[model samples]
Target: MPAPFTADTVTVHSPATSANLGPGYDSFGLALSRYDRVRARVRSAGLNVRVSGAGADELALDEAHLVVRAMRAAFDRIGAQPPGLELDCHNDIPHGRGMGSSAAAIVSGIELARSLSDDGRARLSDAEALALATELEGHPDNVAACLLGGLSISWLADGRGAAARAATAEQLAATGIRPVLFIPAEQSATRAARALLPEQVPHADAAFNAGRAGLLVLALTSRPDLLLTATEDRLHQGYRAAAMPASAALITALRSRGMAAVISGAGSSVLALALADQAGAAAELTPVGWECARLEVSSGARTSGA
Candidate 1:
């Protein structure tokens, strides 16, 4: 699909993300430099989707599209009559690669809905946006990182989920660690990867991951040296290894070399937290078919022409 530049467009640039950054599991997420662009304009009374880039051929072009669903979800939340929308999506985030491509779409749509409401109200508040996105996303980590930027830590208490952002780009700059992603051609569905986890784990293993999650936060914020031990996980990755053997093997190999490596989100993409000076070090270890990129932690989502 062709993307035409126009003065009437409201556009958003949302970053792709690596979630579950090591031991934090569903509670952790990190935004990467790569992004997906969404351009939206108010239409009369229908939906139109024009997609270019990853999954363009396979993704829906109408109401069933993830972006459209998100917009509807947002409109319902605000008690606003939904407006017609025309969406031009340029998706770069790899699908099913544990990179939060879906989260990007969800955030883009919610923002689009906010940008197009007829009431001419102030833009959706951050809290409203987070709540709407979380309702559609089923968790807060990835969507929070995509919506709020930087690194996000989410948890559930009293059957309600709450998320907070940390490790902003400025903080990461001070920490002296770089994010290196190893992306494989093969895709592993998040649902399938999640299914591999057992219903129960050893009490010791659960305690181990809890301790590591705390250390991982420290490593991400002020203590880069602790990253080697901090990224270790005893929860989901090992159990999901069979779903993406290549990713599992590559993570193991990277860690063996003293790099702090772990599955990016679920599987199929590996993130190695490398020292800033050694950012390029993980590239040499990439296997034959996988791709590697060094990414900075993004600040947050941005919208123009809103």
Candidate 2:
């Protein structure tokens, strides 16, 4: 049997996602137009991972590389040894700006593995693909939006742990929600951001965030006009503001500017008002030193590589 990867290299383009929609935290996410185009070609020589575009030249190309690790994980799942392959990544998303670079790499690797699997083609079902990606990315927020495409709302099942570090094998099978998200440039390590918390929060603030997270879903499916009121937050945003004070500040600015902006996921990015009427003009906010893009709420969050 010929190796699937041994054939002409397969290529894929994955979109990035913004998570935690202001107050929704972990549960809300939206897909964007930005992408990382991945081309995988099995080579007769040793494994070679080539990166191009955006921050490609600045990336590391070794075994511990995220792309390589993800590809290896996919092959291992199918009980097959990965063939040496040349991977070229046109990275359009910033490395650690809270976009979905990690998600794109994981999705690209999973797609490569599926493209090179035993049945000569062991593609993953959308749900299966989402599950595996969530496992690698450590949460469904970015993976679900990247794999499924669009604004999605996903949460741990009845009493599951935090979405960031939760064992998402089963949790990935859960449902998703929609949101308006933003990404800012004021960045920090997720762990470091998480470390700033005082461990306990006033029950009032906790309740405030919980109620808004719930409203985030309703604002999308039920009444979008209510989002201004629904997407408000108290817990994650306030705590993270210590590290990303600019995130909250910017959201306020956008709101005053008539844009419904919110902090994206953990920090450093902002998800601003995006809808049919506002989507086009939204890109104008490409502030100096900030890469702004017009993101949409789609169902399958994917784009053509070309």
Best by TM-score: 1
Per-model TM values vs. the true structure: 0.93, 0.81
Shift of residue 176 alpha carbon in model 1, Å: 1.4
List residue ranges in candidate 2 displaced over 4 A. 4-6, 120-128, 156-187, 275-287, 298-306
Worst 10 residues of 2 by lDDT: 164-173
> Model 2 compared with the native: what TM-score?
0.81
Instruction: Give Cα-based local distance difference scores for all models.
Output: 0.83, 0.65
CA deviation > 4 Å runs, candidate 1: 1-8, 118-123, 157-160
lDDT of 2 at 286: 53
Alpha carbon lDDT at 183, candidate 2:
50
RMSD of 1: 3.7
Q: List the residue pairs that clash in candidate 1.
A: none
Candidate 1 achieves a global lDDT of 0.83
